[model samples]
Target: MRAFLKKEWLEWSRTGRFLVLLLVFTVFGIMNPALAKLTPWLVEIMSESLTDMGLVASEVTVDAMDSWVQFYKNIPMALIIFVLVCSGSFTGEYEKGTFIPVVTKGLSRRKILAAKALLLYGMWTVMYGLCFGITYGYNEYFWDNSIAGHLFAAAACTWLFGVWVIGLLICFSAFAKSSSQVLLGTGGVAMGVYLLGMFPKLASFLPAKLMEGLALLQQVCEVEDYIASAVTSGLLVFLCMCMAVVCFDRKQL
Candidate 1:
């Protein structure tokens, strides 16, 4: 496992993808706070412009919690984008026939899959830690008593959502013949779940709740009204990981 993880890291680091992801995540972290600070001014400008068109303007106040909310919401989008970008893990190699040599060298298929998963997880863990550290530092510098209670637990749930996405991506990779196909498959499922979660009755049980209900965890929202949504998200992550392993184990590659 250690050797495989090392090989995975070396490949990613050499390709410069790791650096790019870190830079992007750092930018997202910094921008979250900056956007939070500018939101009120933005609202005021919008109000003035709309007032000229006979639209009434309502008072709006921006706060630290709003910053955290934006951070949580925006980070997931970044994570999903990363997921789509890196969907080529196994499929790309199969298409290019790059894995044939490695596989022939006696590397087990299961190890290969596990290595890639570990690689993706490692990249995500570093990016998330950096993003969180930056957000916490700036948040402390800019606002008093801004950190919400249960923030870590909330963050854990959000991270679990990303893990679930990764697991699905792995499963998709195993089942599909190409990266584009994998992406389409995973995307279709995500879209279906997202649409289903729109109904109030289904919202409590949908995996999409993790990505959609982040604001409540950040103290920028009152979604505590739906405790079931949070529980469902956690359950989804656990199940998805199991599913990924099962699917990969059955794959012919």
Candidate 2:
């Protein structure tokens, strides 16, 4: 497992795409706070322009919660870009017959799957940490230090949602012969789950709550509101990982 992880790191480093992702996501982190700060000003400017046109504008407001909202909302888009870039991580090697040498050398397929999962999860965690560190730093510098009690819980929920996403990708990739197929399959599954979560009663049990409702934790939600979703997502992530292992083990490479 250690050697497989090292190999994965080596591969990731040589490509440098990971570095690019880090830079982009960190910018999103920085941008979230900046936008939160600037939104009111932008709205005022628009309002003024409207006034010049003999139109009226209502009051607009911006707050720390808005900053975090931008953070969580932007993350899904960032994750999509990350997935697109990484979808080829395994499939590309398979297509080029590059993994044959490594697999033929008696590397356990389970280890390979585990290594990839671990590496990607680590990357996601690092990127998330960088984002949150910057966001918190800026929030402290420009806003009140006391965040809404549930903000951290919200962030934690989103982080777990991202893990579930990665797990889904891994499982889908096992059945997909091409990178595009893997991405489409994973995206479809995620969207399907999200749609199902839209039923009013399912909010408490759905992972989509992690992405949507968690951001509002500072508002009216009790801690228990997010607890169920978090637990469900954790279970889904485990199931997805196990499925990936089983599918890849039976897959002819």
Candidate 3:
């Protein structure tokens, strides 16, 4: 497993996804605070132009919570890139027949799938840690950092959402014949989830709420409100991982 993980890390570095995630998160870290600081100015700039058109600009305040808002608002972009990067893990190998030799050499297919999903989560963990660290530092310096409780729990909700994405990518990669199919399958499911989130009753129980937990970070929503969503997200991840293993075990190498 150590060797497999090392190989995966090396490949990720060679492919530049490592650097890309690092840089993207770093920029987001900086942008969160900068945007929070600038949003009031931006609204002011637009306020004058809009006043002439009989439209009044609402009062907007920048604060520590705004930084969290930036982080959550930008999560979709991060997840989209994550899906693209992870969807090709096994599909490309299968398409090029590159995975056959590994299976034939007695390396377990289950191990490969587990490693891929775990490593993807591991990558997210690292990038998110860096992003969180920088954003926290700036938030402290720029504004009062005395945030509400359960912020880490709220953050974990989104990270759990990323796990679901990885699980789906691996699941689709295990079953799809091509990388495009893998991408489409995962993307379609994500779109479906977003659409479902529009329904309030269902939204509270869905994993989609995991991505929307910024309110929890702001203490506007209670931590208890996220318990169901977190549970649902975790169950989805487990189901996807299990399904991927089962399907991959049956697939012809």
User: How well is each residue in 1-253 modelled by candidate 2, as lDDT tens digits?
Assistant: 7987887888888898788888888899899999999987888889978999999888777666677777777888888888887898889877987767888999888888888888889898898888888887888788863655577777777888888888888898776799989998989988998998879898789888888643355667766777888898889999988888888888887
C-alpha lDDT (0 to 100) for residue 224 of candidate 3: 83
Which candidate leads in TM-score?
Answer: 2
At residue 190, candidate 1 shows an lDDT of: 77
Residue 47 miss distance in model 2 (angstroms) = 4.3
Per-residue CA lDDT of candidate 1, range 70-135, in tens?
A: 787688778877786688877877777766676779887778777888788777777888887788
TM-score of each: 0.81, 0.92, 0.89
lDDT of model 3, residue 232: 85
Give residue 114's error in model 3 in angstroms: 1.8
lDDT of 3 by residue, 30-120 (tens): 8888999999999999999999999999999888888878878876687777677666778777777877887788888888877777798
lDDT of each: 0.74, 0.82, 0.82
Error of 2 at 21 (Å): 1.0
* TM-score quality measure for candidate 1: 0.81
lDDT of 2 at 228: 86
Worst window of 10 by summed lDDT in candidate 3: 144-153
For every candidate in turn, the CA RMSD to the true structure comes to: 3.4, 1.9, 2.3
Q: What is the lDDT of residue 52 in candidate 2?
A: 92
Query: Which 10-residue span in candidate 2 carries the lowest summed lDDT?
Result: 212-221
